[model samples]
Target: MATKDADKKDTVLATAKERFEYALSRESENLERMKEDIRFAASSPDDPWQWDEATRKERKNNRPMLTINKLPQHIRQVTNDIRQNRPSIKYRPADDKADVETAEILMGLARHIEAHSDADVAYDTAADHQVTSGLGYIRVIADYISDESFDQDIYIKRVKNPFRVHMDPDIIDPAGSDAKWCFIDEDLKEDEFKAQYPDADPIDWQYASDAEWYPGDKQVRVVEYFEIVEKKTTLCLWANGETSFKDEERPESVMAVEKPLKERSVMKCECRWRKLNGQQILEGGDDGKVFPSRFIPVARVVGNEYEVDGKNYISGIVRNAKDSQRMYNIAQTAIVERVMQAPKSPWVAPAEAIEGYEKVWQTANTANHSFLPFNHKDEAGEPIPAPNRTAPATVETGLAQIAASASDDIKAETGQYDASLGQKSNETSGKAIMARQREGDNATYHYVDNLGRAVRHIGRIILDMIPAIYDTKRVARILGEDGEAANAILDPDHPEAFTEVRDENNEIKRIFNPNIGLYDVYTTTGPSYSTRRVEATEAMTAIAQGNPEMWQVAGDLMVKSMDWPGAEELAKRMRLMLPPQIQAEISKDEGGQPEQPQIPPEMQQRMMQVAEQMETMGNELQETKSDLQKAQQKAWQEEGKRIKAEIDADKANALLAIEKAQDSAAAANPAAGQGDVQEMVNQAVAMALANLMQQREPEPMPEPEPPMEMPQPEQPPMDGGMPMPESEVPQ
Candidate 1:
C-alpha cells in the first residue's frame, strides 16, 4: 500500500510541474510587458527617464532636463480616498431576504477580516496601482494556528509577487469558471523552498560545494496553480455518516452500505516546483501541495483599464499624466536653457581703435559696475558707440504658455483639478466648487467602482469559507446593532443552530442555519451609504428635539453612526437618563406593557391628604366605640335598680291583699269559717308568692347613648363682635 501511495504522489507532482511550465510559457511575454509598463510609470531613482548612459551624457550638453514625477501623487490621492471610505463587510439575506444568523456570521467574519487584513490589503492595493503594471492580489488562507486567541486562523495576506500573476484570459468567473490561475514566486531561498515540502528530498544546491550561500544563487522557484480537476466524490450513506456525524466516539444512529458515486469536477491547488530558479531540472516530491479550497487564495483586482485591442490591463492614472508631465518637463528645460545662453550685459568696440581688450573684458566680468580705460581711437582715431541687447520677452511668454498648457492637460487627463485639492479656484461659490469637484470625482469613479468590486469579491471568498471556518460549535463574539459585543454559538453542525434568541413576544427567534442555503454578500457603497447614517441621525435628532418622544431611539441611532470611543456605552447611559415613563414605554413587551412610574406633584399631594383623612376617621371611630360601651353599661345598672324597687312594692301589695282576704273569712262564719280562713290565708300566701315572682321579672337592656361629635375649632367674629356659627368654622 505504501509503495502504491508513493507512486501516486510522484504522478501528482509530475503533473503539477508540467502545468506550472505551461502557465509560465503562456504568460511569459505578458509578464515582461507588464514589467516594462511599471518601469515607465514609476521610473528608477538611478535613471528617472530610463535613458541610457550615453543619451544622458548627450542631453547634458543640449538642454536642462527635469523629471517631474506626478505618478506617485496620483496614486496616493486615489488610495487616500479609498482609505477614507473603506468598505466593511455586511451579510445580507439570500435573495434579499433577511437572515440574522447569516448576518451575524458575516459580521463576525467581516470584523475578523477587517481587523487582520485591511491594512495589508490597502497597502498592497495602493502598491499594485502605484507600480502601474501588476494587478494586486490578496491571498486569503485558513489554517489552525495554536497561538491564535480565538482559535480562528484565517489569514488575508498581501504576498509580494515576484512575477506578474496570470489567469485564463477568456474566463471571467474567478472561482466557478474552468480557468487555470497560478501565482508564481521565483528565486525562493533553499530554506524557504524546503519549508513547503519538508517531507521531500533535500535540494541539491548547484553552487554549494565550494562557496557560502549567496542571495539569488542556488534558488528554487515555487508555483501554486489552481485548476478544475475531476474526482470521484462519494455521496453514499457511509460517506455521509463519516462526514456529517457529529460524534466520532460513537457509531452513527443510521447505517447503510457504501455505494458507487458519480464523478464531479472541483477546483484544487497543484503546487509545482523547479530547481535552480525555473531550471530544466525538476524536484522529486510526494504529490503536489493541494488544499480543500474551492478557489485559490490569490484574489485579482483588475484596475480601470479600457480594453482597446483585447488587452484588458493598462497603466492607471500615471499613464494619463505621463505625456503632459513630459511636455511640462521639456518646456521647463527650454526656459532654463534659454536663460543660460542670454547675456546679462552687452559691449561693443571698434576693432581698429580697440586697445587692452582682454583687460576691459576682465573688468566688465569681475565688477558689478566698472569703467574700462581704453583709448577710443582707431588707426584713423574714430569713435564707435556700444549697444546693449534687450532681454528676449518671447522667452518668458513661451515658458508661461507652455507651463499653463501642460498644467491644464494634466488636470484634464487625471481629473485632479484645483477644487479636488481644496485649493481656491475661479469658481466663486462653494456650491460651484463642490460641483466641480464632483465632476472630477465622477471622471475617476471607474477606479473606485473597480475597487468596490474587488472588495465584494473578497467578501464572496469569506462567505465561501464560512462553512469551514464555523465547522464546529464555537462561541463567537458578535457585534450588535448598538455596537455592543455579545457571545453567540456558531454551530454549522446542527439544524436549529443560533435558536437561543427570542422576540418581544417571548417566542423563539432563530437566525437561519448556514448549513442550509447560501447567503448573498453585498457591499454598502456611494454617498447614500457613506453619509446616510449621519443624515438619519441628524433627522432623528431634529424630530426628537420638539417631540421628545423619539429621544432614546434617535440617540441609539446616533451612537451607532458616531465614530467615537465608548459610543455604545454612552448611548446606554443616555437611555438611562430618559424619563421613567418614556423608559417604561420603550422597554415594554409586545403583550405586556410596563407601568409608568412617574406621578405629578399635585396628584401626590392630593393622595397624601386623602390618606390623612382616612387616619383621622379611624381614630374617631375607636373613641366612639369606647364611649358607646360605657353608656350601655351605665344604662344597664340603672334598669337593674328600677326592677328591684318594683319587686319590693309588689311584695307589700300582696301582703295587704292576703290580710283582707283572711278577715272576710272570719266575719262569714265563726266556727265553720276558721278552716276557711286558714285555707284562704294559704291561698293568699301562694298568690303573694306568685305576685312577687311576677314583679321580679328581668328588664330589657337600655339603649346606648349617641356618641359625642368632635367640636369644631372657633373662628374670629365677623364685623360686629358676634360669635361665629359652627358651619362657618374651619374643620
Candidate 2:
C-alpha cells in the first residue's frame, strides 16, 4: 500500500507540471500580442499604412460593425475571471460534479486556439490616388470709384471659378473620368462630371450671386488651374450655375486658350510675413528694398476680352494671387480636405451616401451600435427641390438608403422618406457642417476644423507595436487537453457560424418600404435584395454581441478618418477588418490584468484587524485539494462491505412456502393452469415478498399544480359600507 501511495503522488505531480506549462505558454502569447499593439500605435501616428484622411473618412463612413454580439461579452467576463488570480483549474476528473471537468477542458482548448488569429481578408477601401494641379477662376471686385457707370452700388461682378482639372485624356477614371479621388485612395468625380452635361438632370449647380446679364462696363475675372503643358488640355466647367446672372441667354462657362499677346508665367507669391518696426510696429508698414518680401509684387497679369450673352466683353486676367494664403480657406481641394468625407464635385453625392445605404441594409442595431450603421452625411449644400430630384427607394426587408443628408435631410431619421415623403431637420446630418466647396462657379469657401493629433510623445514605434489585440485561444486551451488540443474530447469542430441559438431568437422587425437594395438589382440569385437584407441584419445583430468594443473603436477611427486626410485612418481601419467578436475577447483578456491594490486607509485598517483571525486561519488551512481526493478514493475502496449475503440466507427459508403456493394455485384453477402458469405466479410472489427479499418500495411522485388557497368573495363592500344612498354608490 505504501508503494502504491508513492506512485499516485508522483502521477499527480506530473499532471500539475503539465498544467503549469500550458498556462506559461498562454502568458507568452499574451506578451507577444501586447508588443504588437504597441507597435501598431507607433508607426501610424494617426493611421498606419498612410491611408489618407479622405480614405479613412470614406471607409469609416462606409463600413459599420455588426454589434449586438454575445461572444465578446462572454470573453470579457471570463478573461476578467482569469485576471483576478486564483481561478479554478479546468479539470480534476472525478473530483468535479457532472461533466464540468470535460466542459472546462473544452474551454481551455478554445482559449489556446484564440491566443493567435488568422484573418487574411481585407475590405472597405476608398478611392485610389491621382495627381492634382490647382486651377483658377477669377472674381472681379469693382470699387465704384468713378460712379459714371450705371453700375454704382450695383457692382457688375463676374467670377471665373470654373476651371477644368485637365487630366490627360489617357489618365481616365477606371472609366472616362476627369474627377480625381476627393477622398483618400478612391476614384475621382466622374459621376459629377457626367452630371455636368446640358441634358443631364443630376445637376449640382448653384447661381453665384444675383442678376442675369452684366449689361454695361462689367469686369470679367477668369481663374483657371492648369498644368499648361505643350499637350492639348480640356477645360471643364459647370453647365447650370456658373452663368453670368446679368446674361440669362448665355452658357454658364466656356473653354478658352492663352492668347499670343498675353505672356503665361508660373504664378508666384512671397511667403506670408508681417510688418514690424523697431517696436514690432511700423508707422505705415515694414519696408525692405534689397532683401524685401512682405510688400514684394507676386503675380503677372494680362488684359483680355471674351464673348458672353451673345457679345464680346472686356475682362482682366489674374496672373496670380488666387493661390495665396488669402485664398487657402476657399480652394475646392482645401474645402474637401477640411470636410470629413470629400466629394469630387458639388454635383455628385459622396461615398458617404453609398456607405450610409449599407449600414442600415446590414446591421441589426439592438444596442444602438451605430457602429455598423450608415454614418450621418453632411448636408450643407443647397439641395435641388423634388420633382427635380429622384428619391431613394425603400424595401420591406428594412434595406434602403435614407434621404437625410448628414447635414439636414431628416426624411431618413423621421422614417418619412419611405412614404409619399415628409422631412425636417435631421440633427444627425453631418452634411450640413460640411467643408463648403471653394471653387464651383459661384463657389464660396469656409473654415474646416482639423481634429487634434499628438506629435509622437512616445517616440518608439517598435516599443508600442502590438500584434492582434484580441483572440480567444487562452480560454480555448484552458478547456481541452490531449496530445493535440482539438483531439481533447470536448473541442467542437464548427465554431463561428452559429445557426442554432443558445438564447431566444432576437429577430428584427421588417417594415414595408417601396425601394429595394443591391440584392434587388441582381439578375439571378437566391432571394431578392429585400430578403438578403433581412438575413444580413439578423446576422449582424448576433455577430455584434460577440464584440461591442470593436464596434466602438471602429466608430472612433471613423471620426479620425473624417479629420485626417491621407493614410491617416489606415491602422484603425485595418483593426476593424478583423472578426469583431475575437477582437473584443482579445481586448478584454489583455485588459483584465490585476491592478495593484491601492487599498484605502479605512479598508487597510479593517483588513489588519481581521488578519490575526480570518486570514491567519485561511493560511493555516491551505491544504491542496489533491490530498483530500486521494484519501476519499482510498476510504471508498476499503469499505466494500456486502448486504447480499444476509439476504441470500433469508431467501432459503422462504423457498418451501413459495413451493406450497405454486402447488395450490395449480390445483385451484386447473383450466387456468396453462404450461408454466404456476411457475410465473411463483416468480412474481417471490419477488414481492419483502420480508424474505428485503426489497424497498418506490417513493410516490408529487401532483402538478396542487391548489393551495381557499376561495374569496367576488366583490367587496363599498368604502363606507353606505347602503343608505343608492345614488351615491359608484357604478
Candidate 3:
C-alpha cells in the first residue's frame, strides 16, 4: 500500500511537470511570431542581416538618410487621445430600480478600487503600448500581506507589463479577457525567493548571475502559469423531517438522516510552476491545484477584433506610410537640398585673360570671402564678366508638392487633420468645425472602442473579485452628487441589520442596510466619453448662461465634465450657491422613492415649537374676538331700548297735543261741525309727526311699530252727545 501511494504521488508530480513543459514549448513558437510584431511596432523594422554596419559602409551615400518616420507619431497621437479621455468605470444596479444602498455600495467599492489601485497610470501605459505593438497586455492579481494587523487580507493590483508577458497567441481581450493558459516568467534574486518562501529549500537551486538581468549574483527564473482543471465536489443533502419524510416515518431512532452525496464537476485553477536554475528545476514545487480561476489573471488587449488567422494582426499607422515617408525623404534630400549643387555660368574668355581662375573657383565653392581672385586682363584687354545662373523653378515646386502630398497622405491614413488637431483652418462656422471633428472621430473610433472594451473588461474583473475580497465590512468613499465625497460601508456578506442609512444632512433614517456587491459594471461612452470635454463644456456653458434655468438643472454636470482647471472647486461652489431650502431638491436623485426631507433634529424641534406657539396665539385671538362681538351686541341692544323709550314718549306727547288742539279748536270755533273739526285735527297731527321725523336722527333699523295710537276724541258716538269723556272714549 505504501509503494502504491508513492507511485500515485510521483504520477501527479510528473503530470504537472509535463503540462508545464508542454505549455512552454507551445508558447515558444508563439513568442517568435510576437517578436516580429513587437519589432515592427517599435518602429525598428530593419532586417538585421541585410542592413548591418558592413552594408552601410559599402553604400557611400553623401546625403544623410531622411526617413520621415511618422508611424510612431500617429500611434502616439491616438494613444494619447485615449489616455487623455480616460473612461471612468461606472457602476449601476442590474435592475434600474434596485435598492439605492446596494447601488451606492457598489459605486463606493468602485471608487475605492480606483483610488487604491494604480489603474489609471496602468491604463495609459497599456493603451499606448498596445497601439504601438499591435497587442497590449495587463494583469490583475490579488495580493495579501501579513504583519501586525489583518491576515490574508486581499487587495487588487493592475499590472501593466506588455513586454515580458506570454499568453495564448489566439486570445484578444485585455479587459476582462480570458485565456486557456498564461505564463509570467521573470528572473529574481536568490534573496527574493528566500524572502517570499522562507519554508522552502533555498540552497537547492543553482545560481547564474551573468545570463539574467536581475540585480543579484544568484539569479533564478520564476515560471508561474495558470491552467484550467476540473475538480469533483460532493453535493450534500441534509434531511428535514417535515419535507423528506412522512409524519409516521419521522426519524425516532436517530436525530437526522444523511442521504447519499451527489457528485458534481467544478472548474478550478491548477496553478503550478517551478523555479529553474538554468536547465534544472529547484527542490520545491507547487503540488496542489488552486481552485476556481474563473479568469486568467493576464489580460490581452488587441488593436482590432479577435483575428482567427494570425496574418490579420493590426499593424501600426505607419505601415501604409512607409512608401510616403520614403517619397518624402527623396523629395527632401534630392530636391529640397539640391541648391548646394547649383550650376554656375562659365565665362568664356581668351586663355590670356584667364589667370588665377582655379583659386577663384575654389573660393566660390568653399569660402564666404569679401573678394574673389580673377584675371585682371585678357589677351584682347577687354574685361570678361562672371555670369550667374538660376536654379530651375520646377525643383522647388516639386519639393513643395511632394512634401504637401506626404502630409496629406499622413493625415488621411491616421485620421489626424488640421481640424482634429485644433490647428487653424478655413472652417468659418462652428458647425463646420464640428462636422470635420466628427469625421476625424469616426475614422479613429476603433481605437477608442477597443480601449473602452478593455476598460469594461477590467471593470468586470474587479467586480468579480469584489464580493470575495471585500466579504467583510469596509468604509469606502464615493464621489457623490455635486462632486462631494460620501462614505458607505462595503460589506456584501453582512445582513441588512447592520446598515445605517443617513439623509443628505447626515441624519440617520430608521431603516438601514449594508447590502453591497449586487451590481453591473459599465464603461463610460458616447461623444461625452471622448477627450473633447473642454469644447463641450464651453458650448454647454454658453447655452447654460443663455438659459439660467438650464444651468440650475445641469450646472453640476457641466462642472464635472468640464475637465478644466478648478472644475471640482467650481462644482462645489456652484452647489453651495443654491438656497438651503432647495438644495435638497436639486440634489434629489431620480431613482428610488425620494428620501423624506432630511430636516435637522434641532430645526425640526424648533419648527414644532413654533407651530405650537402659533396655535396658542390663534386660540387667544379667537377668544378675544368672541368677547368683543358679544360686548358690541349688548351695547346695541341697550341703545335700541333707549331709542324705543324715547320714541314712546314722543308719540305720547304728540297724541296729547292732538287731543288738546282738537278741544281748543272746538271751544274757539263753536259753530264748526264735528266732521270738519276731526279732519282738521288729523291733518295738524300728521304735519307735526312729519316735522318730528325730519328733526330726529335715523335709527340703525326702523324703530319697533309705536304701540300708542291717537285717542278718539269722544268720537261723537252714535248718540251724538257733546263728545264723550276723554277717559271713556276708547277705554
Candidate 4:
C-alpha cells in the first residue's frame, strides 16, 4: 500500500510537471517580450530611460542622463478616463426559462458582489497593467464568508503581477475564455513552505530549473494549476423536460420508474484546481476537487492581441511610443550637452586697454558695477579701445527642432496630442476642440474596450458559478443602477422563484434563483452614477432656463437628478405638487400604486348632496321624456282617425250622386234594360270618386317639439376638494 501510494504521488507530480512545462515552453517568447515591455514602461531607477549600459556608463562621468518620462502622463490620461467611466456588467435572459425580473436580480447581485469585493480596484489595476505592460488578469474565487461559516461567497480578485500567471498558448480568444489550463505561481521561503505543508517536499522541481520559476537557494516554488477535465456520462432527459446526469444522485421525482424521455451520451467538463510542487501534489490531488463552474476563473484583459504566422502577439499603448520616448530623451540630453559646452559671455580687448582696470574688468561678469574706468591709451600713448563684450554661443536651432519633433512623435505614437493632453491648441471653436479630443479617444478606445470584454467574461464566470455557490435559500443584498441597496430572498427550491414581494419601501422586491435560468452577460462602459447625475443636472438646468414652463411639469425630475443631500426628499415633495394625472404616471413608473385624493369632510358632504340632487333630476328628466313620447304617439293616432273620417264622407257623397244619375237614366229610356242603367250608374260613381280624390290633397302630420333640458346642480371643485357655496348651487 505504501509503494502504491508513492507511485500514485509520483504519477500526479509527473503529470503536473509535464503540464506546467508545456505551458511555460509555449509562453516563453511572449513572456520575455512582456517582461521587456514592463521594464520599459515602469522606467524604474535601474534603467528608467532605457539607456544603453555602455552609453550610461560613459555619461555617468559628467552628463545629465535625465529621464523625463512622458509616457506615464499619457498612460494616466487613458486610465483615469476609464476610471471616471467604469464598465458595468449586465445580464440578459437568453431563454424562455429566464425572466427579465430574474435577470435584473442577477445584475443587482453581481453589482453587490462587486461592491463588497471592491472590484473597482481589481478592474482598475488590470486596466493599468494592460495600458502599461500589454497584459492584465483578474480571477474569480470562492471563499467562506468567515472561518465559522459553511456558506461560500464568490469574489473577483486582482492579480497584481501579470508575470505570476501563465495561460494556455492555444487560446484564440482575446479574453482568454477559451483557455484550457492555467498556472499561478508563488515563491515561498524554505522554512515557510515546510511550516505550511510539512508532508510535502520542499525541493524545486527539475522541470522548474528556470531561475524565473524557482526563486534560488532559500525559496521553493508552488504552483496553483487549474485545468479542465472531461468525462463521458449518460444525460437523461426527463418527461418533465428536465435534464440530469444519470450518475448523479437526484430526488424521487427524477428517480421515478418512468422511463426517461430521452437519453444520450455527453461530455461533461469540470474545472479542477490543485496545489503542487516538484515532488507531489500538496492539495486537491487525485481526489479531484473541482470548481462549480466549468469555465476557468481567470480572465485576461489585453491591450491589443493578434496572431502572426500562428503565433500570438500582445502589445500595449507603450509599445509604439517607446521609440519616440527614446528619441525624446536623446534629444533632451543632446540639448543639455550643447548648453554645457557653450562658452559664457567674455570681454575682448588689447592687453594695454585693461592694464589699469584689470581688477574691475575681472569682476565685471560676476558683479553689478556702476562703471569701469579704463585707460584712455596704451603704454605707446595711442588711443586705447574699451573692452568689447562678446555674446555667448546658443544651442543649435537643429537640436531644438529635434527635441520638439521628438515630443510631437511621442504624442503622435500615444495618440494623445496637445488637445488631448489639455494643452492649448489653435482650435477656437468648441466643436473643433472636441473633435480633436475625440480623435485621441478613438485611438486609445481599444484598451478600454478590451477591458470591457474581460469584465464581461468575468461576469459570465461568476454567473456560471452562482447557481452552485449560492444554491441555498438566503437573503442577499442587491444594488440598483443608481447604487441603492435592497434585499432579495433567493429560494432555488421554490416553485415560483420569480414571484415578487413588497419591500420596506413598498417597492416590489423579486424572489430570485440564479440556478433557474439561462442568462447571458454583457458590459456597458459609461460615466459613473455620480458623474451621470452631474451631467443630468446640468442639462436639466439648461432646459429649465430655456423653457420655464417645462419646470412646472418636470421640476421633480430635475430635482431628483440632483446629487445634493436633500434632493430626493425635495423631489418627493415637488412630485406631490404636480398635476394628479402626471403624478399618477410618475408613481406608476416608480413601481408604486397611485394614491387616491383625500377629500375634507365638508367637501365630501357637499359632493354627496350634489350627487343626490343630480340623480333626482335625471330621474325626473327621464319621466318627462317618456310622457312627451306618449303624447306625440297619441296625437299621431288622432290625426289618422280624422283623415279616415274625411275619406268616408267623400265616398258617401259619391255614392249618392251615382244613385241619382241611375234613376234619371232609367226614367228617360223605358225601352232600355235595367242592366244598362246599372252600368251607367257604376261609371258615374267611379268618375265622381276620381274627381274628389284629385281635388283634395292629404296634409302632412306636425313634427313633435324637442324636450327642454333640466338644470343640473353645481359640482364641488376637485382642486383642494373645495365645496361650492349654498348660494351658488342651483335650487
Candidate 5:
C-alpha cells in the first residue's frame, strides 16, 4: 500500500509538472507582449517612454529625454467613465423551474455578495489593468466567513498582477470563460513556505534550478492550479420530469422515488483545484476539492482580442498609442535641445572692438550693465561699426509641427479627443459636443464591454456556488436595485424551496430562494442611482419649465427626483397638497396608498356643515320610521283583540243552539241520559270556537322600507379657494 501511494503521488506530480510546462511554453509570447504593454502604460520612472537601454545610454550624457506621457490621460478617461457607470450582475430565468422572483432574489444576493466582498474594487482594478495592459483577471473563491464559523461565503477576489496568472493557450473565448485550465502562481520566502506547509518538503532549489519563475534560492513557487476533469456518470430523468446526476448526493425521499423514466450515459465536467509545485502536489492530491461550478473560477477581461495566422493576440488602448507617445516625447525633446543649444545674445564684432570692455561684454548676457565702451577705430585708424548683439535662434517650425502631429496621433490612436477629455473643442452645440464624446466612447467601448463579460462570468460562478455554499436554512442579506439592503430566508429543504412574500393585494411580490432553479446570468452597465436621479431631476425641471402647468400636477415627482437632503420629505409634503385624483393616479403608479388631499380651511368648514345637515336629515327620517312602526304594531294588536271577541260570541251562540237541540232530543227519546246531552253541547262549543279562530287569522307585518340614500355633498375644489381649470381637472 505504501509503495502504491508513493507511485500515485509521483504520477500526480509528473502530470502537474507536464501541464504547467505546457501552459508556460504555450503562453510565453503572449505573456511577454502583455508585460511590455504594461511597462509602456505604467510610465514608471524605470521605463519612462519605454526607451531602449541603448538609446537611453546614448542620451544619458546631455540629451533631453523628456517623457510627456499622454497615454494615462486617455486611459483614465475610459476607466473613470466605467467607474461612473458601473456594470451590475443580473439574472434571468432560463427554465420552467426558475421564476422571476427567484431570479430577482439571486440578483439581490449577488449584489449583496459583491458589496460584502468589495467586488467594485476588484472590478475597477481589472478594468484599469485591462485598459492598461490588454489583460486583467478576477477569480471567485469560497472562504469561511469568520474564524469561528464553519460556514463558507463566496467572494470575488482581484488579481492585482495579471502576469501571475497563466491560462490555457487554446482558449477561444475572448473572456477566457472557456478555458479548461489555469494557474495562479505565487512566490513565498523559504521561512514563510515552511510556516505555511510545515509537513511538506519544500521544492529543492538546486534540483529545479532550470525551471522558470520557480525554485529560487530565497523563494519557492506555489501554484493554485485549476483544471476541468471529466467523468462518466448516469443521469436519471425521474418520473416527475426532474433530473439528477447519480454522483450527486440525494435525500432518501428522492432515492425512494428514483424510478427513472429514462437513463442516459453522459460525461460530466467538474472543476478541481490544487496547490502544487514542480516537485509535488503540496495541498490537493487525491483529496483535492472540487469547485461547485463546472467552469474554472478565474475570469479574464481582455481588450481588443483578435487572431493573426491562427495565433491569438490581445491588445489594449495603450498598444497602438505607444508609438505615438514615443514620437511625441522625442519631438518635444528635440525642440528643447534645439532651444538650449542656441547662443544667448552673443555680440557680433571684431575682437579689437571690445579690447578694454572684456568684462563688460562678458557680463552683458548675465547682468544689466549701464554702459560698455568699445573701440570705434582699429589700430590702422580705420572707423569700425559698434558691436551689435545677435538675436537668439528660434525653434524650427518643422519640429513644432511634428510635436503637434504626434500629439494628435496619440489622441487618434487612443480614440480620446479634446471633448472626451473635458477640453473645450470647436463644437458649438451641446448635441455636437455630446456626439463627438460619444464617438470616443464607442471607440473604447470594447474595453468596458469586455469587463462586463468578465463580470457576467463572475456572476455565473457565484450563482453556481450559491446553492452549495448556502445550503443550510439561514437568513442572507440582499440588496435591491436602489441598494436598499434587506434579509432573505434561504431554505433549501422546504417542499416549495421558496418563501412567497405577498404585497398588500396578497400577490406574490418576491420569492426568496437561492438554492433552487437554473438561472442565466447577465450584466448591465448604466448610470448609477445617484447619476440617474440627477438626470431625472434635470429632465423634470426642463419639462416643468416648458409647461408650467406640469408643476401643479407633478411637482412632487420633480422634487422627489432631486438628491439633496430633505428632498424626500419635501416631496412627501407636496404630494399631500396635490389634487385627490392626481394623488390617486400617482399612488397607483407607485403601488402605494394615496395620501389624503389637503383641504382648505373654508372647504373643511363646508364639509362639516354638510355632515351636520346630513345627520339632521337622517335623525328626522329615523323618527318618522319609528312612528310608522308603532302605528302598525298598535293596529295589529287591536285587530287581534276583535278576532278574539268574535270567537267568544260564536262559541256562546253555538252552545245555546246545541242546548236546545239536546232538549228536543231528550223529549223525543225519554230514555236519553242527561250526561250525554251535556257532552254533545260541549262538543258543539269547541267546533264553533275552532271555526271562528281559523276564519279570523291575523296577517303578518310588512318589512320596513330600506332607509333612503343620503344625498352626497358636492366636493369642494382642491386648489385652495380657486376652481381648477378645465384642462387641469381629471377627466
Candidate 6:
C-alpha cells in the first residue's frame, strides 16, 4: 500500500511539473509574438489605401522614354546587320547610337519569333497559346500573385480580354507531394499549429471591434450608407493580415464582374484573419548580413463590398455585418413565447369563471422567452387559450385515506408519525391502512404515508423531477466551467457542497440549505402577474392522532377546493371536526353565516328606533337639500350664461380692434403693410388677453348646514314632551 501511494504521488508530481513547463513556454512565445505585432502595427499602421496603389499599378504598364526632338548634326551609321528594306535603322546623333542598336535587335527578334512560330503570339490566342516563350512566361508570374482562392483571375480571349480565372499551382506546393494543411513550430514543443509552414504571428479573426455585439442586426437593418447610385462605409479592422475589399464596380479575383450588380446585392462578415509573420531581411551592407526589419501580415478578411443596380440598388453590402441565421433564431423564439402565453379570453371573462381561478391569470404574461413550446393549437388554427394547471385526481372520491404497512404499524405502536403526513389518518398497517396498495413505479420509490404531516403537491412535483433531470444536468454544466464555479452552482442538497459556500464573515455553513431552491425559484421565475399560491395539505395519514392542527389552513383549503365536489362526505367530515375558528372561516367561505349569529331583542329594538329616525330625517333632508342644490345649480348656470355673453361681446370687439390695427399699420407703412399682418396679430393677441382678464366667473356658494337627526320617541311621552334622563326618571 505504501509503495502504491508513493508511486501515485510521484506520478501526480510529474504531471503537474509537465503542465507548468508547458504553460510557461506558451506564455513566453505569445508575449514575444505580441511585442512584434505591437511594433509592426505602430510602424506600418493600418494603411487603408495601401492596396489601392497595388490595385492601380497592377492593371496597366507604362514605360518612360524621351523623344529625339532635335538630332545632333553628327553622322550616324546603320547597324552592321541591319535589314535594308526596313526603315533605315539609324540615329541622327552618334551619341544616341544605343537606341539604333535596340531597334535593330527588336526587329531581328520579331523576325526570329515569326519565322520560328506560325503566329507571333497575339494575346489570348486559341491554338498554340499554351506554348510560351521567355517573354510570355514573365506575364504568367503576374497572374500567380493576382489569383485568389475565392476570386479566380480570368483572361478573355476575343473581343474584350477581360480578367480570366487561372491559378499557378506552384504557389501552394510546386509538386502536390506531401502537402500538409497545418503545422507547429519545431523549437517549441508545447505550442500547436495548423499549416505545413507555421507563421510566428498568426491571427484568428478577420475583423472585430469594441462595438457592442448586436445579434439582432441580422433581422432588419438599413443598407450601409445607402444612396440612390451608390453606398459605402468605412470599416476598420485592427488585425495583422494583408486584406482587401473586393471592388464591386469591377469585381474580380473574389467578387468578379460576371456576377453582375443587377442580379443580387452582396453581404459579408469580414474577420481580421490577420497574422504577424516575422522574417529577417538585410537592410544595407556589402556582406549581405541579415537583420529583422519588421513583421507583416500575409492575409486578412476586411470590409465586404457590394454593387447594387444603378437603377435598382445603389452599390453597397446589403446586411452590413450580420446574417439571416441569427434572424431566424430570434423570430422562432419570439413566436414561441407568443403562442405559449396568449391571453385566454379575448375579452373580460365573467366573474363566475374567475372566482377561484386566481392563479390562472399569472399565465397571461408568463412568456417563456425561448424557442420551445408544448406543441398545441386550436382547431381553428390559432393558439390555444392558456396553461390552466392540471388539478389533482380529477373530481373523484378525494383519496382521503392512505395505505400503511409494517413501517407504519411500528410507528403506530410507538405513537409516532411521519411529518410528511398529518395525524388525522390514524391508519394502521394490515388493518385500516390497506398495506398492499402501491403504484406502478419501483418498490424502492413507494412508501406508506405517515399521518399529521402535510405534503404539498407542487413541492412533490419538483422533488420527483429532481431525481430525473435538472439536478444532475446543473451539476455537470457547473463542473464543466472553470472548476471554481462548481461551488456556487453545485447541489445545495449535499452537506459537502454547502461547505464550499462562505458567508460574509467567510465562515462556511457546513449544513445544506433547503431555502436555496425556494429563493432561486422566486428570483429567477417570479410570476409575470399577481397570483395567489394554492396551499395543499394531505394528512400524511398515519399520525393524525397526535396533532390535528398540523396542516390546519392547508387542509381546509384543500377541502373547500370543492370546485370538484365528488368528495362531499370527506369535506363534510373535515368541516365538522375543524376547530371553531376554522369552522367559522369555512362557513363564511361556503356562503353561510356562523352558528347563532344574530342580534338580541333589546338591541334590535334600539336599532329599529335609530333606523326609523334616520329614515324620517333622510326624507326631510332630501327635500330641503334637493331645493338648495337645484337653486345653486340654476344660479351657477345663469352666471355661466352671462359670462358666455360677455365673452362673445369681447370677441367681436377684439376682431374690430384687429381690423383697425391692420388699417393703421397699412396707412403708417403702406409699402410693407398690405401683406405684413404682424400688427394685426399683435393687436388681436393683446385684445384677447384683455378680454379674458376683464370677465369674471361666478363663485361657488357655501354648502348648507347639515340637517339635524332627531329621534322619534317610541312612545310619544303622552304629550309629545321630551323624556328626562335615566338618572332622574325611574330606572
- How far out, in Å, is residue 397 in model 4? 0.5
* Candidate 5 per-residue lDDT over residues 218-263, each given as its tens digit: 6877888788888999998876667788878654456664577788
lDDT of each: 0.58, 0.27, 0.57, 0.84, 0.81, 0.29
Model 2: weakest 10-residue lDDT segment is 122-131
Ranking by TM-score: 5, 4, 1, 3, 6, 2
Report the lDDT tens digits of candidate 4 across residue range 494-536. 6654887786886786687776668889999999998888999
- Model 1, global lDDT: 0.58
Point out where model 2 deviates above 4 Å. Answer: 1-311, 317-624, 634-640, 653-731
Worst 10 residues of 3 by lDDT: 712-721
Q: On residues 649-703, what C-alpha lDDT tens digit does candidate 2 reach at each position?
A: 5566577667766776777777784667767666757664855445533334323
lDDT of 6 at 225: 9
Q: What ranges in model 3 sit over 4 Å off?
A: 1-61, 92-100, 144-148, 151-161, 170-176, 188-220, 234-285, 288-293, 305-314, 343-363, 374-400, 424-429, 477-484, 496-519, 526-731
Mark the 10 consecutive residues where model 4 has the least summed lDDT.
207-216
- lDDT by residue for model 3 over 119-237, one digit each (tens)? 66767777775665455666666655346645232233544555456565445444536566565666667788778766544332223234433344855566555654444443332
Listed in order, each prediction's TM-score against the native is 0.66, 0.16, 0.61, 0.76, 0.82, 0.17
375: Cα error in model 4, Å: 14
Report the CA-based lDDT of candidate 4 relative to the real structure: 0.84
Best by TM-score: 5
